[model samples]
Target: MIKEITCISCPNGCEMSVEVVENKIIRVENNKCERGISFANEEIFNPQRMLCSTVKTSDPKNLRLPVRTDKVIPKNKIFEAMKCINNIVINKNIQMGEKIIENLLGLGVSIIASQSLKINSNNV
Candidate 1:
């Protein structure tokens, strides 16, 4: 089977054709760089994506704290990861890049704060 895909691994966005047989990549064409080959292989076989979302916060000034996975995770597990993140509530101040959940879903990826959230005393 021939599949067409646009490469997002670089700025070129090269559109390429990939041939697959028995769930394995047979050939790739029209790719501008080596990264496109890697991208095609992973995208076709085991796709991954970085999860960016928000977690509830107790701070009145910042009701939602931005968070994201420190590394790309299996695409199939994104929903499960989101459910876990949604259940967490930050009860205190946190800094940007601080780890919120370590080894999320045992995928060796950590959920971290994308932005700092500090409780505002005036809001209390």
Candidate 2:
């Protein structure tokens, strides 16, 4: 099976043509770097994607906080992962890189705060 993929490993965005046989990569073409080859192979077998989204926050002034997975998760699990993340409501100010959900969905990936969020004192 010949599959085409756009390499996201670098800015070049090399379009790749990968030949697979029984889940094994036989040939890779149109790749500029070695990383592209690896990216293409993974894309055919176990594709993954970084998750970035906002979670509800307790502070009214800051209704949502941006968060992201520390590592790439399986592409098929993105929706399930988002469901787990959406259940969280941070009650205190959070710092960037703080782990919001550890080992998210048992995928060995952590969902971390994308930016620092301070408390909103104006709320009575």
lDDT of each: 0.94, 0.91
Which sections of candidate 2 miss by over 4 Å? none
Could you give me the TM-score of model 1 versus the true structure? 0.92
lDDT of 2: 0.91
TM-score of each: 0.92, 0.90
Number of backbone clashes in candidate 1: 0
Q: How many residue pairs clash (N, CA or C atoms closer than 3 angstroms) in each of the candidate models, in the order given?
A: 0, 0
lDDT of 1 by residue, 70-96 (tens): 999999999999999999999888999
Give the range of the ten consecutive residues with the poorest summed lDDT in model 1: 115-124
Candidate that would win on lDDT: 1
Among all windows of 10 consecutive residues in model 2, the one with the lowest summed lDDT is: 115-124
